[model samples]
Target: MPLVAPVTVHKISGETLTEVPDLLAVEEPLEIRLGFGPITDRQQRSVSVTMRTPGHDEELAIGFLFSESIVQKPTDIISCRHCVQDSQKEGNVLRVELHPDVVMDWSRLERNTFTSSSCGLCGKTTIDAVMALTPGPLSADFSIEPAVLHALPERVRQTQRAFAYTGGIHAAALFDVDGKLLLVREDIGRHNALDKLIGAAFWQNWLPLSQFGVFLSGRIGVELVQKSWRAGVPMLAAVGAPSSLAVQMAKEAQMTLAGFVRDNRFNLYSEPDRVIIGQVMAFKA
Candidate 1:
């Protein structure tokens, strides 16, 4: 489906009002279903229904599963595709079939209720619940220069195709230590955009993304930190500020977190050693 839709709006500038054509980021519900269990006794269940921009649905589903700790590796998924039961639900439903040998964990599904595009951890019961699923502290073997971090926001902005048109979408981008953009994903939801980026990397067997950094188009939230940490991304920078809980979590995870990463300046919240200044160093990666 198209990521943006045409619309007409009345523009009011000063005393003049004029009708102009515009574009809006499309928001729609995507139901992600899981197919698991042994080959002889397969079972299916609806896990998540999220409102998101309609593009890269499969990546979003896989990324969501990975971020939730439901699926660990790319091989864990046997297949992922759109499977509509009713005609009314066409292009809105997706199914991910897991390998038969994978053990099922239904409790994880209970933690997530209905997810909105704006918030990812809406139904999460507590911080402890989220921490339980979080991975261990990242390795401090990687480092990047402040100049590389400053270049991320503008590079991400240039690649935001949907946002360029609608001016109403979030983005997540991956970059190497040298400031090279690897991948970018756009969505109506900030979390969803990160999920899609992670999902794409997961499909390419790029988990344990220790050598790369993830840059967000919005503020750093606890959930976003958790997701990036789960993906093994040691460094995260964003165009906006980091929440208190997000900074706390980043410290606990041993991850480098930078916020307000625009206009040649950024604030490091944790693992500041990874970002070197006034010195030249080599990264372990």
Candidate 2:
């Protein structure tokens, strides 16, 4: 299905109302299921039911699994498929089968983990539990030029085909240390977009994202910070303000978090040692 849908909007200009055709980002519920055990004997469980953009459903499903630490690497998944044979369904259900012997905490997978565009830490019981999920303190010595950091939001925006068309979605893009756009995904929910990026990178065995960074189209939240940290990305930049939890988590993870990245300037929330402007200034993490 097409990622975007056409809709009618009423434009209001103080006293004038005009009907116009507009584009909207389509949001749908994607049921991510996990099937484990042998090829002949398997157990199925519904892990997450998330609201996401419809396209890239497989990527979304595997990405969600990876970011949530349900599966650590691409080889963990045996196969991924939508319930295409069920005529009663709209094909939103994605079942990911896992290789035998790959163990995960089944108890932690049962919460439904309902997340939204605005926040990703909805149902966690404690802050420490959330922090426990972050991969670890980063050890990458990579740095980005300030000009490279300043140009990221626009560069990421340039690849946001969905956001440019609909203006109603958030985006996440993964970039290498030298500021090359490696992968990009857009979704109504910010966390979902980042999940998709992380999942794709996992398939390529790109864990410990030591040489990479991420750019967000919306405000940085603790959840995004946590996901970026889990992926081992050294620098995280956004076009909006970050929350206190996000900054604090970034500091703990030793990840560079930058925000308000627009108009040729940006603010560094944590780990400023990774950004350079011709001179290598002394800084501590």
Candidate 3:
């Protein structure tokens, strides 16, 4: 069976019962373990246990490592493997092996009880926690026209295939200099979707996403800003509003943050200089 599927349920409300079809959200536990070289020098460390949809476990692991600063280059990772003792047991745990010299600082990650599809960022204690680990934003002189920002939400909406069917997944897409869609990834968790996109980019040998722009399907939160900065994305656009702290982080990173992008309109929260607003207006006029 595939990881996700749709089901119908009947509910009664005051003698009126109707069968409604709804998309089921898959929740599964995945434990990530890190192994560092040698049988005698082998040190196994448990990193994070994230509950995510089952597919793309390797991408999730690599994305986690990249976002956490555990590994810089792809060569830092020696190999990735998954093991399941029994199919009945939730045992698809992933183990990643990093180069012997790769240093890991586990202090940056917060211990969360359960990271669900919808509430991936809710477990965060404060913005300061994310800021401490988040690298400074891209210091590039890149700029995007407001017209390009206005056109993105519709383009992104059209690209989300899973969302078209389920309407329950989040998406993150990258666009090139000419505002062409480069890649997109959809997942139950917003952060995971972004991570999967970043992981895919890394797999394609496209690191430092400063030359491109990232468009998200939801609001820009602290976690979203942190992940974008870590990926070196110069500009981030969202279909919903951005948190105050997210704007602050964008300012610190010198990234252009725009939100509420819908219907040819958007709110530029920070670093307006990175947006060619006048050019868009001139073009419109």
For lDDT, the strongest prediction is 1
The alpha-carbon root-mean-square deviation between model 3 and the true structure, to one decimal in Å, is: 4.5
Off by over 4 Å in 2: 85-88, 110-127, 278-285
Instruction: List clashing residue pairs in candidate 1.
Output: none
Which wins on TM-score, candidate 1 or candidate 3? 1
lDDT score of residue 255 within candidate 1: 90
What's the distance in Å from true for residue 169, model 1? 0.3
Which ranking of candidates, highest lDDT first?
1, 2, 3
lDDT of 2 by residue, 108-152 (tens): 654323354354554334245655776458879888888887778
lDDT of 1 by residue, 48-106 (tens): 88899999999999999988888988889999999878988999999999999888777
Task: Select the stronger candidate by lDDT from 1 and 2.
Answer: 1
In the range 1-285, model 3's lDDT, one tens digit per residue, is 245687998988999999998766565777889998565688988787776766777887888778777778899888887866577644568889988887756554544211332554442344445555555446876787777888888888898776777777788899875678999877787787888788888877788887999999998877778788888888999999998777877887788898999988888888888786554443453
Model 3 off-target regions past 4 Å?
1-3, 11-16, 20-22, 37-39, 89-91, 108-137, 279-285
Runs in model 1 with CA error above 4 Å? Answer: 112-128, 279-285
| Pairs of residues clashing in candidate 3 | 137-253
lDDT of 1: 0.88
Best candidate according to TM-score: 1
TM-score of 3: 0.84
Provide the overall lDDT of each model, using Cα atoms, as 2-decimal numbers.
0.88, 0.81, 0.77
